[model samples]
Target: MSRDLHADRVELSIPATVEWLLLARTTGAAIASRWSFTYDEIADLKLAIDEFCLTLVEGPGAERLDLAYYLENDSLCLEGRTVLATPGSQAASDSGATGAVTFSADLSARILDALVDEHGISDGPGDGAKTAWLRKKRNPLS
Candidate 1:
């Protein structure tokens, strides 16, 4: 029998706006809790999610954001992507670009480093969409 690498996973998509950031944070908190993550760890996950999501929304003005949460052994992984608009699409015209916008700031990087075990922002598979990801390990003692 083959075991799935991810024991549990959840996917979410929301309009790329600050107004929707609360939902993203809430989702992270809920998933972290389900895995029995400590309260401090859950708070860290929520803050990390908010920071990364806010960067995507505020930096490049993405039209939509896609997020995936994966539960692995003793860790929760989060992957968030900006849905790049197609060339000549209404969204592209509105945003004034078809290529993904890179998100990088010294303060944000430092904050994520402190909050999560591992984190990064990179280009996604197609259309150069930007994707940000993080992994938070459960505290063994907690």
Candidate 2:
């Protein structure tokens, strides 16, 4: 029997406009529910996703954010790629908050730490990363 249960991937190209952040967040939140994540787990997943998206939307004039979601039977993987339009640092997400901090001081690292602590983080292809293909169902593979 194949170990793969089933998976879905959703790719959304979001304009770096601040308004679109909510849309990206909502889309991620909706997808999380499909795997039976609890409320807090769902919220945490959304926050991690938003932070990932924020990383791609930082800077002064950028116009796009690459938002990706990989859904499996017991896990949800999210990745966001951003291009800064100016000569400054990128935005980062804070711990426990479903939001981003522009030009964060170590908050970006915190975001990764939090996600890893909560779920577990993994690096993806060049310039991209998988926040956590968090394993929610302990025995889903069984």
Candidate 3:
């Protein structure tokens, strides 16, 4: 197994533009590689982050994007945050305020489901701020 790269947790904040998303991909790949992820796994992690950002960028307007990376014994977890366009929108499910955030039934959500091992969204720390997260486990061979 790979050693933890983000024992203290790492964060990246950038403008919500598509061009800046490359930074996220780059950061993700570097962290995954440092943690001994396979080439294929690193590529998958980059694509997963790209798709996740594309989804959020295309949907609502976000002032900024906040991403947090957590390295664990067997997995790397990424958390993304942004302010929602509508606080009362379908961002949260109808299941009574678990403060969960969800992607609209769209292509981005489908792509995310196919790529990452696990991914989800939730309310951020600030008001009207929402967050999405993805977890990619290290390959058993690593």
Index of the highest-lDDT prediction: 1
Give the total clashing residue pairs for model 1: 0
Question: What is candidate 1's CA lDDT for residue 50?
Answer: 86
Error of 1 at 45 (Å): 1.1
lDDT of each: 0.77, 0.55, 0.73
Encode model 3's per-residue lDDT on 12-130: one tens digit a residue. 98766666889989999998888888999999899899877665554444656778887876798898887443554443223312123444547677877887889987655565566
By TM-score, is 1 or 2 better? 1
Checking candidate 1 for backbone clashes, the offending pairs are: none
Q: Model 2 clash pairs?
A: 56-82
> TM per model?
0.79, 0.60, 0.73
Better of 2 and 3 by TM-score: 3
With candidate 1 superimposed using the best TM-score fit, by how many Å does residue 81's alpha carbon deviate from the native?
Answer: 0.9
**Superposed Cα deviation of residue 131, candidate 3 (Å):** 0.9
Candidate ranking (lDDT, best to worst): 1, 3, 2
* Residue-wise C-alpha lDDT for candidate 2, range 32-85, written one tens digit per residue: 766556777678766766665555444334435676677644566665655333
Candidate 1 on 9-54: residue-level lDDT in tens? 7999987766687999999999888778899999988888888886
On TM-score, the leading prediction is 1
Q: Report the C-alpha displacement of residue 83, candidate 2, in angstroms.
A: 6.4
Error of 2 at 59 (Å): 2.0
